[model samples]
Target: MILFFGTRPGKTVITQLPDTACPYCNQIGTLQVSKTSSYFHLFWIKLFKITTDTIAECSHCKRVYYENEFTEAMRKELP
Candidate 1:
């Protein structure tokens, strides 16, 4: 249920496709993205955009990744 960060209907637990990466440690295994939300208003409410919490985590390092923030991107570089 690969949950896209800052998407609609809230978060969905992802499984079956195999673990991707730590998004922190860059290690691939049992890494999961969590249920969190942010905002983007097109034709809707008052708030145009706001940042909530959509963190990807590294079970190893226990670091929280905020949407594609610094730690998340660095995962790819890990060996």
Candidate 2:
């Protein structure tokens, strides 16, 4: 028999910051905050979360950035 074990990244859109502008695209009301988790999986079944992080993205430019890269105003806007 063979067993498969590996890790994958899962992402959830926490909230939309309609008031914030995307730094990369310079687009207004396009920034969104998302939570990402890395987890181990067995046979494609998720086991447990290994790590987590928050990110900000621009719908217009498809730019992704970590929470620490967000400005004070942008950070406060996250849910």
Candidate 3:
């Protein structure tokens, strides 16, 4: 018998931050937050979620910020 199991990324959820400025570009209302979940799968079927990651991106500068790189203002806007 053979088995196939692995982990895959789930759908991404995006949220717009109003009145929020990008930490790097300093552009207001251009910051968007994206949340993604990783799930464990067995035989192409998702079994359970492993972890979730949050990130912020600047539409102006195109910079991506991870959770560890989030600022105080950015943290407050997270849901």
Candidate 4:
């Protein structure tokens, strides 16, 4: 029998953050909080989640930031 298994990432938009200064693009209101989870897949179907990650996305410059890079204020804003 042939078995197929792999890992996949699942993402969720936590929230649309309010207008805030973007360190990368120096823009306001262009950042959104998102959550991503890595999952194990079996036969092309998701089996169980392995790990999770939180990040921020900038619409202007299209930059992605991990949770460790988030400022104190930004951390508080996460949902």
The most accurate candidate by TM-score is 3
lDDT for each residue of candidate 1 in 1-79, tens digit (9 for 90 to 100): 5533432443444422134665445676745556444565444433334544555566678776655573533344323
Worst 10 residues of 2 by lDDT: 10-19
Which residue runs does candidate 3 get wrong by more than 4 Å? none
Please give the distance, in angstroms, between residue 56's alpha carbon in candidate 3 and its true position after superposition: 0.9
| lDDT (Cα atoms) of all candidates against the true structure | 0.49, 0.85, 0.92, 0.84
> 2 or 4, which is superior by TM-score?
4
How big is the positional error of residue 79 in model 4, measured in Å on the Cα after superposition?
Answer: 0.6
User: What's the TM-score of every candidate structure?
Assistant: 0.39, 0.64, 0.87, 0.70
Best by lDDT: 3
| lDDT of each residue in 1-79, candidate 2, tens digit only | 9999999998665788888888777798888788878999999999999988888888899999897799877977765
TM-score of predicted structure 1: 0.39
Ranking by TM-score: 3, 4, 2, 1
| lDDT of each residue in 6-76, candidate 4, tens digit only | 99988665777785767887888888988888999999899999989888988889999898899776777
Q: After superposition, how far is residue 51 of candidate 2 from its true place, in Å?
A: 2.4
Each prediction's total of clashing residue pairs, residues at least 3 apart in sequence or on different chains, is 1, 0, 0, 0
Off by over 4 Å in 4: 23-28, 60-63
Better of 1 and 3 by TM-score: 3
